[model samples]
Target: MGTLKAWMDYLNSINGKEHDSFFKPYKEGKWSKAAIISHMMFWDRFFYEERLPHMLKGETLVGITAEQVEEMNKKAEEYAHSGITLQEIIDEALKYRQMLLDKLQDEDLSRTFTIKDRKISLQEYVNGEIEHDEHHLKQLKAK
Candidate 1:
């Protein structure tokens, strides 16, 4: 939950025009703020839909491949620019993220997953995702 309030604050501070403007792609082929937000949304949804059910049941999962990651990102970016309202996307993300966190609250943090040949705990993975959120939040703030 660390830094989650900051994300909510930022999102709440923005108006519809500001939200829609985020759909404009950045220079040099970088992702726009809308794309970034949607990217986070997609990953959170993935965890909710694909990863968490397994994790909650104590199922060990293989890490997603690089290609799969790229595919997801691409789809997220596409969705961001596909004329959907930013509010809808953000709402979807927050919904799934809340569900994921709530479900994990009582779970064992010591649960391990092997990603790229290294063992990582659920706590560590969640921390990494929080950091990712911070990184993107900073980027969105910069624009």
Candidate 2:
């Protein structure tokens, strides 16, 4: 519940910003708000739609490669500049979060997964995503 509350607060704070500004590019070489949104959306979607199901099925979760991480960043940049609306990205993130919340209630939080050579539980992974989101949000707000 605290996590959900924090997410709601974060969403509310972003809603206060201008729509155009929310998706505007950050300083050159940095991720724009749109890119950040896409990154969040991607990870959220991954955890709720892919990773969670894999874990539930007792499948081995392979580590992420450095190349894949780079690709993810590249895709985020593409998504940012793709002319998709910020609200659409936000909605996707919300849907992903809700899916996680729903699944978490019934799943074992301690279930572990291997990603990038590290072993992390479902709870830890989700918290990492929240942290990543907040870091990007700060970057977005500072721009």
State the lDDT of candidate 1 residue by residue for 1-143, as single tens digits. Answer: 56445565566677344454577765457888888888988998887788767665555677888999999999999998898888877777777777776788888978876656677787787787888889888788884
RMSD list, candidates in order? 2.4, 2.8
**TM-scores vs. true structure, each candidate:** 0.83, 0.79
Weakest lDDT window of 10 consecutive positions for candidate 2 = 1-10
- How far does residue 19 in candidate 1 sit from its true spot (Å)? 3.1
Per-candidate Cα lDDT values, in order, are: 0.77, 0.71
Model 2's TM-score against the true structure: 0.79
Top TM-score: which candidate number?
A: 1
